[model samples]
Target: MGILANTVSFRQYQVLGDPPAGDPGEWAGPLLAKNAFVPIDSGSEEISSGWVCLDDPQNGSFAERRDFFRPPSLAFTLRRDQRRVPAALLRRHLQKAEEEFLAAHPGLHRVPKDKREELRDTVKGALLARTLPTPSFFDAVWDLERGLLTFTGTSPNIAEIFEGLFRQTFEGLRLVVLHPFARARALLPAKLQPLLEEQNRAATDAVLEQIQENTWLGADFLHWLLAHSVAGRNSFRVRRAGPALMDEAFVAFLDNRLVLAAGPQRVTVAGPQDHYSEARIALDAGKEIAEAGIFMEKGEDAWKTTLKAETFLFGSFKAPGVKPEKDGITDEKSEREAIFYERMHVLAEGLQLFDSLLLAFLEERLAADWPKRREQLQRLLGFEEQ
Candidate 1:
């Protein structure tokens, strides 16, 4: 089963700084209305047209309710409408218009440049007028105590728009992607606090090693997993805070094509399951993992999702089966609440697993041991079998 429904993908972020004082709901009400979405400029190539409240727009009930501070969730809709004037269609129309102009003015030898330009504008305006805007829903849930907010998308572009709009809506607030170091720091033991600080301070001379920004550490971490699949029995483990593990059991690499279903039950695998060999080859050839589908058993439940290599953002996560209501009846509100809780729990475990793996990588293993691990991978893959 797909890990998530309704939402196609996921992007998680931590809201930086403290939340505003007072009832969050009361504070959010006015701001939501002020920054509510409007339609896009149909003729322009702009994508982030405007935002509207998904819960309520005209009535401004979003402000009337107090969910922003208590539990911390905001739902909104973004619209993008674009119309492209096809070169061929515009050319044909212009040709027709030019012929009509010529017919109307027989003395004119050639259509003036200004007249052609005017026709192009006319065609563009007409096309734009007939176009409809596309709407997308963005859900944001903040963990007020933890200063974190997860956006239900992974697109950097969308994330940027969300960041801009969020700041506009909630002044002095910023959303930053929880990088490998930041995430790892959260899971590391108190004794290992120095390791995170070493990395953060850019301590070039520190013995614990440091990570640079924009380094493909997440991809490298996955590659390291492929290399030390056997060593995972002793090498990869996390304890103290919460039980978390990362090994071969949780990873799948998807290159291009994907499989939907294969069995008579019509059970569909979201992506190409048989492409494991191809994925490995792609990795061997130095192509980074575009997407990593991971299944992890954490805190007594199985959670699965596709994680982006660049950002470690979870996408399309599926939790275990849901129990039906005892009376065989459920309301839409209860169902929504149930799914939201499940998603949050599954996402929490996934993040923990991610942080555990990242900590393992940064804990002297990558810098001190990755070279030998690389040789092992090259040998296993027949690149240097000798």
Candidate 2:
């Protein structure tokens, strides 16, 4: 009971700042249209918003409810570093300020000014011990590496709220899910392939070709996705539940592999494009790291983790040093720096291409399926004139 009470007081403390002020949602465009969503009054004009909805009946299929794939918003306060504020100095400053104010105010108070000044000083110091909790939301910012959003909460969900927000304002924009299994697998070492053979063997090109015929129109592509997973394992029982096959949990296993393969490395940062930005080193002497970042994205201001996706798309390194067989005139430091910079550019380019691939995959799938899905929805809504 005590634990539950403390928990409720948490995000509960943030309700005031989480939602936007008033009804700016009137003019709101589709949530997915602009990278940053802004709500405004649209009046009688038709407007659409983008929303991600889960149709699972087990997880509340009722109208206007939704579990959040990301945190909607957050709230906290910011104050100065209390340790930096000296108690004696602050006391004296407060003492002077109060005396000045009282002298200026003249006939306002019958209370002894000295005692009142001391009380005010004590109260001021307590407040200034710098409580800097930011009631701020990192909503909509996706952590590309982790495949999750920042500032999310525990199990109690808001799926309906997400759906309602979408239906009311973003009736046309699209929401998408990106699977990075294939890309992550490709990044693994050749020696580790055997362990994931069950999954890889299924997603192979040959099996994918066979899946084309089984692909059903107007159905969620989830069926095709499952089939593809089996194409890698070569077999899976239909009766099997949850993630019916090895590949069904692609993101989970891939993330695990990334953690292992991204073992200790001499990570070198090379570009001045963000030279001023702090570079990151994974596998620190003491750290739990499946990923790392080159800027503050991994730290205090991580509203931009996905934004760094393009800057650091693919992460790996080749054998270090000039080949031992024939390397003569080498100022090693200079050589290392040059190589590092070259590597940085190559990484940036790869990230750009990878991001493009993710975008392309979603574009093709949405265009091909959404039209038919819309028809089905209309029929369900009785627009089919049955």
TM per prediction: 0.69, 0.21
Task: Give the 10-residue window scoring lowest on summed lDDT in candidate 1.
Answer: 259-268
Total backbone clashes of model 2?
A: 31
Give a tens-digit lDDT track for model 1, residues 1-386: 12234323566567777667886666766776676665554544424345554433223334445323335454444433345566787788778888898889899998889987887777666665665545456556667767777666567677777778788878888776765555665656787777456445444522123334533556556655544442333233543243344342343223233222112222112454442455455555555554556555644566566665545666676655554344458775455556655655555655665565566666644344656766776565445522
Give candidates' CA RMSD values in order. 7.6, 23.7
Candidate 2 residue 78 C-alpha distance from true site, Å: 24
TM-score of 1: 0.69
* Tens digits of per-residue lDDT for model 2, 214-331: 2221122221222222233222122112212212211100111112112354333333322112221221222122222211111121111211121122222111122222266776
Please report, in order, the local distance difference test score of every candidate based on alpha carbons. 0.55, 0.28
In order of listing, the candidates' clash counts read 10, 31
Query: Residue 266 deviation, candidate 2, in Å?
Result: 36
* Candidate 2 deviation (Cα RMSD): 23.7
